[model samples]
Target: MKDTQIKKLIEAEKKRQKKAINLIASENYVSRDVLEALGSELTNKYAEGYAGKRYYGGNDIIDKIEELCIDRALKLFRLDPNEWHVNVQPLSGSPANLAVFTALVPRGGVKQEDGTTSVAGKIMGMSLDQGGHLTHGQKVSATGKFWQQIPYGLDPVTETINYDQLREIAMKEKPTIVVSGYTAYPRIIDWKKMREVSDASEGLMMVDMSHIAGLVAGGVYPSPFDYADVVTTTTHKTLRGPRAALIFVKKDARELYKKIDKAVFPGLQGGPHANQIAAVAVALKEASTPAFRKYANQVVKNAKVLAEELEKRGWRLISGGTDSHLILVDTWNDGKKREPLVKDAAGKAEAGAGAITGKEASERLEKQGIIVNKNAIPFDKRPPADPSGIRLGTAAETTRGRKEKDFKLIAKKMDEILRK
Candidate 1:
């Protein structure tokens, strides 16, 4: 605490968080125990490898801490240790995903005599504009640079995943892997259909359940373990843990666990963050309790209530409503029963009026102590910096003990701010 300047900034941030209405879907507040573990003396240690197999000496304690975290992660989701292998390293979600793809998916482009190369395989994932994460093969990410992405998106009419169309694309594109879970998506994914698509295409299936990991552990959302070959999730987000990630590999004849472990350690990172691992262990244990289950269910309920209230107040909701903690509200267009915009061939907007842009709405909300991110709607014409929608989530406020009525008021406040 000798660094007065840094301490003052940290205190300022604390006050800001306390005063603001946080609706960021991928964010959550951790407990004191988790914070204590994060700042523990374990950060001084350097354990350059997995538990009991470290390259450095005097790591017995670090080994125990990591192993406990791995065990708790499996136990929280009711996974059999024998059937699943957990990698507790991989700094965060993005790297965790990269490690998985690097381990399994082939980076095509062998040199060709004609000075052109063919893509040996593709990653079939939901399009980023349609609620998928960038790690799922967006053009700007490293994953896309190394491998091609075959993007699928929501149906124009229903604003939800068209499974039949997804199957048709998978069958034709023949992707190396089909990723099911998403970042901004609010509906429950049909894991069975994704599995069938993967099967028909003879590809692997991976689920990035980072957004809903806690809900799955609480038995409120469906677990992807039964369908996915591998599952990657962040310990933060709905998990309410430290900023860490876990990669779960299903034990099969393919020996994916070995590949994933190697990819995480020597493949992607050096010594794992022992302190962060310990904190994740605490959160996993905390998430296993009955109280966390109630919290998780309440998160979904609060989201539904907020979405309903917003729609009733004339805000446009993508996909009609949400089945999870996240809600996507179209802020650029007029309210429910609004007319559609005219578009050019490139899908750029040609005409619209009498509505607020996502960026303007977000800025207005923040001035009123509300926090939310401007996001892209499905088939959005606007750029990523200021799209047509703003995403909201209930986990953080719900953790602060807010309930249905609180969220209803939040919706009312948001509606008033945006409409102005």
Candidate 2:
């Protein structure tokens, strides 16, 4: 009976995916090959340590698979094998970030023999109002609660990162870590400049590339490996793998590597989920192919076209445009006022204004088989739960083979709903 219920739930989920246009930025669809690897017999084993030095026996096969994954990841990032180390053991993106923090911060200010100090410092990244992820330093996240999190906001007039201001903040604060990544941001990051700031401040540069890892892998975006000391990413987003995460470290950080492995195992989690690792391996292999490059290019192209179409329809877009798969739409304009009146006058409810909130707007669109999440806008007057912005992306749609033509249709549908 339990197995039967699980099967039914999977069927329902498939139906939902098939019927809806999922535009959420942090979501994607994995291929069957990756899913099969996730359900393989590797989950039954318990390999506690790195490939060659496992705590348990019968780890030869697991080690080979992990090594393959690490090799592919290193190749994808164009890293020298001798100068880089890959840990394919993290359970998810959040845990991966925690591992990075634990490895970099010393326990009681004791400096390591490698000349790298363990002093804890502030983590600088995008502010909540500027479309940063919670892990980057939102007040509610563990990263914020435990560490000193200093946020850098967008230019008030342009709604984009002000690099000069960021450098000013870094010089003033002298943080130990500078993070460059986002969840809703739609522009290409200037990692080279960020690396310069991190160097001047004596800080380690880390990038949470969970949203654009596939793009980086596909050569659609600049690779952070050349400048970042460490990188964290979720395999599911744009990568189209299972729900897992990855942590890549520079080869010079040997002491840091040991600390990260320990933190991932004994410090934060127990046994590593071997199934997820297998799926991640499959996804990494898939990312190394030429076909994935075409997909990544399409994701950006689709986003740019969609943003233009929406703006042409009189929708206010934050940042003027996008260079990535996601875009932020401000919904507090004069045109949005037509929503409540259309339902009352026609005696039939409009498709997207039932509760008179962004959350309600999201729900209404979901009912029409178009999905998006209400997100907080910069300098938003509304609360986080019902912010005056919506975030849409092309990752999932691109995975489903969508392109500019599909986005034009989607923008038209969204415009009609917003106008009503």
Candidate 3:
């Protein structure tokens, strides 16, 4: 109430959110309870270590609070504490993933004859332009600098992951790990196959389900717990919590559990943000309710409707359609129905040299009070800054109480903007 400067900016952001049709797949709106917890007095605490083990004093209440969050996370996901060690201290997804890889693969490298060195170990993962996150091994990220990255892409024709090729590459590359979950690809990943590939290559498997944490909790999408050696996810996306993340280590690998805990505490972060953790607990509790399950299912329903409506409008959908809450559309040109085996002749004349480019479509849509992000479709010729596609998700809209009909209308709005 005192500092109107910050308060006014906050109010302005609130207004913008209220007025916009948010279709960003990686975003969602949290409830009032979650927001309250995020701004509670718990933020004043200085709990550095896990529950019951604090580096500073005055943590009696903090211990119980963190334990409650850990307990709720396990219960919400139906995980047995004996089999999985849950660490709720990660600041976010990217850091959490870095801790995992840093624990498994240290930063030391092999010295060459030239006195130079190369990062040891190889991480097999999806490529960024093909819908993979930067942490998965894009050169720009530290993950790539720390270790070698073996990038895997989708089939040019199908625009979907080919398990056979993945297995072959894993077997030959023999990477240190295999990452299963993705950022933008709108299809269900085969966790079992990924596990098999990891096993054959004598490597570990990790799944970043940050984008669909709520769906996994609601039992709508496939759970990676049964297959992955470790699972990392953010609480803020479909989970509808504050900005926080969780790391789940399989109990079968007790050593890995210990390694991950150490990496998170000493290797990466210092004292955890108790307020965010408290909000995560509240969100986890809310996600376990029956109402959340309905919301999760509806998210998928709305996405399917979006894809269907867009297809009816002659928009080309990458990989045909979506099985989750996200859809990727190639707006470079009239995707309609023709098989695009190459990247040329895609984005139209308006694009000049590039497709509508994700940036153009995004800006045009934003002008109409609709929000979305430009993305790269499979075999996209344009660069990452402006890819050949635009990504749409129904999580935020579905959370706003919009249903299938509303999503269909949203799809039409998208079509109209792209046309302009």
Candidate 4:
């Protein structure tokens, strides 16, 4: 490493990771083998097309690497190669999702003065404020720009999904596709109910299982494959892989695989990152082992212990509890006397009692070597940047060999910090 500055920063990050109690739900630590693959010589090559159908000449080895990745991905998830097709070339989760929409959804077009047609589609997904990802067609994202989002939310009192309301919305909107998986959602999704909704609306079902892919692989969480027509997931997150994504399309009369493949290659990106693909292959193999299964189960257990401890400590948990590795806690005023901003005699806004915001809670936790993200809870009145809640996860800490006892202690520490 001749670049001394970059090397120093990398070393500093390593030290930081070693000391910090990582709770970021979207993050995880990869193995040394995955790291080696990421920095391998395969990065020097440019394979602009799929395996064996490449535009470049020196891609025979690249083809084999990619084929192995696709094979392991299928095998890890117990999917038959003949029944399911996977595209491992999309740079990350966002582009992978975009490729799916471009391939399957119908884009209604408007004629322009320059004799061109501008097109947009419709996507039905959970509302961002209620635990949806931005790629699920939130207004600020490009997914929203090129497509209109028909949003759904959780039940106000229970703070969990209401299948009846979701079906009604889907039936009314008749969106081109309905997305099931989410970012901040903590419970196991009812894929069968989602399937019914998609069926009633005559729309495609795509589940972005990016957050829970590893749990699904370990058989700890329900697999959405039985219901969803297509599934998109990032290899990172709970998958414990590289920062890559895979799009799996069910083979049927629709021929969705071909459309999505074209969208990923010529329709979206050029040469695939052969190195990242190889790393993902290693991860898929690793995830198939019995040891990884234990790790996945422990992840959920650790999250439960953490959530229960937090609740007992007087913190309000969204949905009351969790069935997955994620938990949302109302760290602010808990929707009670939330008037954190009030006018003084001079008509100037001032901070009031019990006014700790999510942002402040996150900062306080970070100061104590715990890392978490501020998030918006269901029916939250506070803004997204500094919402009324904080999201915590146990995957990374559990990966570091933390258990129920460790999480209990971590929860107690967290309660102490935030209460201050």
Candidate 5:
């Protein structure tokens, strides 16, 4: 508190967040208890390993804190202790994903002249610009560097994932793992179907449900727990927790679990953030309550109402509608004369609506206190620098107690800015 400059900036940020209409899909507001835990004295500790198995001393209490966090994570998520092993120590989702890959993939299968191990496998995930996260084996990510990326995209017209096509691709690629869930696509994922594909291809099923983890907890979204071999989720998104991630492994794979723990500790990270772990514990406890369930349900309700209102004003949403907490809207050239239909880089047809580029639309919205991010629509002709879609989510606003009517009003405000 003595640092006036930092304190002032933090205060300003709090005020700014209070006034901004937050719609970024990957963001949420944590409760005061969670915030307090984040700033607690636990920050000074360096717990290099799991509970009661640390290389560093003075970590007995840190062990208890982490154990509590992992326990709550498993309990809150309804994972049976007999069937699951949870890892709460990956810094965030990206590293959590990397840990999973390192744990599951056969590393050091080949050694080059440099005396370093070479890892090789196919990681099948959704395409990044088409709704996948970068860590899902995108060429630009390290995961892609280590493994061949076999990416999938939504059907150019319906905008839903073509599962038959996905299975065919999986059969051909014989991927080491198949990832479900996404960063931008709004429709619910068919986890069971993904599991089917994974089984058919003899691949591991990992659902990166970071965006919908809270929705899964609240019983709104389809839970991947029963199907995925590994489930990775960030605690912050719809979970309304700290910026931490949880990696869940099915109990049947005891061998894989051992590999995962090693990857998280000595292989990928060291001295896990005890304070963040404690905050994650608090947030997990909060997420387990009946009140949080109501909040999660309301988040979906608000998103639906907002999406409907936006559509009423000419915003064409991907997949026609959303069954989750987010919405992806196409916002490319509003006035361009077009043929009956448009095509993509693959010559596949796409159906959608008009002018302001996603970035320009976002800039205009920000000036009006509405926060959103530019995103690439499936087969978007425009480049990433200026994509054809804007992504929105209701998690933070719904957490602030906004409801269907509030979101409808927010949609009207967005209409005023984007309708031009």
Candidate 6:
């Protein structure tokens, strides 16, 4: 296409992005500097390996950039820069988790030479409904199909992970890997407590900090690096980087690190997207700045303010509150009411609303220039397609320089629609 056509497309996309009230938990706005790096000349090169060792020649500049990224990641995580190792090449979060699992699990299909599976006695992670990711061994996931999965869950009333119950499950199941982190959860994970559980269970604790990575980086949330054996995160969500993922392995897990690298390069993906890596580097650098810290703080503040405002307006919230950038709004009364009000309001709105239920609410919001996703609350009986709750986060809006005032406005709009 000609430059004019390209310019038009860019402008149109920018306009679309700017107009929307992006409340999706997994979304965020990246800096223009990061965008520039993503679209740089690095896209043309193919660097198959780490900084120093590449399969092809002419990687001198790329090597330095990659090394700088590694160093910055280590620094952000408060690890010894020389001792820490990170693989900044994963395509995204799911693949990164898969790579971590592949690395930790014994090769040759988890079965030993004696015709017995090595992981038979080992447990992995909690279930999806229990606030764990698919890689943490949901039955539909490849991980569950291959290895033993011992599911854990949150307390029915508290709506938070029952650490005591989790310990009991860990002790009884004796999992080889205890995965920490979550996708839809809105509170802070106790990595220290999780580390203790992993030690007691003789398992490795891998923390998927994909959601709160920016908060962790900005020092607003606790870093899991101090306790986790392995850490994985997406660069986009809270990090405000490219749509990519990263795997950080502790120094002692050198063998595991090699396995992770091999799994990423050979088992999962081929040549790395050098452009994304460059963007990640720029983002990491940005994350280390004071401005990013302010942004992280604002994300949490906005979430709290939004949650409080919604609650005061009679909207039921999961956990009754939130500590991170996300909040789960319960539309149905303990999964009893169908909530026709949501549909009525969406229908009456301009451009129509997104969806009626949390699912429909999300759809309706998108139609009205606001964006969010429906989510299943704890102890939910419904399928994910039409859950009783909508998940909203402040990362993107905060990145856009929004504050508690903006959150209050968004909350009012959401209340007007859902509580009509």
TM-score of 2: 0.90
Per-residue alpha-carbon lDDT of model 5 for 260-331, expressed as tens digits? 999999999988998999999999999999999999899999999999987766677888879999999887
lDDT of 2 by residue, 1-420 (tens): 479989999999999999999989889999999989888898899988778888899999988888888888788878887877788888888888878877775343557899776654588878877888787756788877767787888888888878888888888888778888888788888999888778767888999999999889888888888798889998899888898888888777345666777888778887677888888888988888888999999999999999998776665778888988888888764234424322445587544422245666677678789989998778877788888778898989998899899999998888777655
User: What do the candidate models score in CA lDDT, each in turn?
Assistant: 0.90, 0.82, 0.87, 0.90, 0.88, 0.82
Model 3, 328: alpha-carbon shift in Å? 0.5
After superposition, candidate 2 runs with Cα above 4 Å error: 106-120, 333-357
RMSD of each: 5.9, 4.9, 4.9, 6.1, 5.5, 4.7
lDDT, residue 69, candidate 6: 80
Please list the residue runs of candidate 1 whose C-alpha ends up more than 4 Å from where it truly belongs after superposition: 110-120, 334-354
Q: What's model 4's lDDT at 141?
A: 85
Residue-by-residue lDDT tens digits, candidate 1, 344-415: 779775333236778888899999999999999998888889888899999999999999999989987887
- Model 1 error, position 303 (Å): 0.3
**TM-score between model 4 and native:** 0.94
Positional deviation of 227 in candidate 5, in angstroms?
0.5
- Model 6 alpha-carbon miss at residue 357, Å: 2.1
Cand. 1 Cα-lDDT: 0.90
Between candidates 3 and 5, name the one with more favorable TM-score: 5
The local lDDT score (0 to 100) that residue 320 gets in candidate 2 is: 85
Candidate 1, residue 39: how far the Cα is off, in Å: 0.4
| Clash pairs detected, candidate 1 | none
Clashes of each: 0, 1, 2, 0, 3, 8
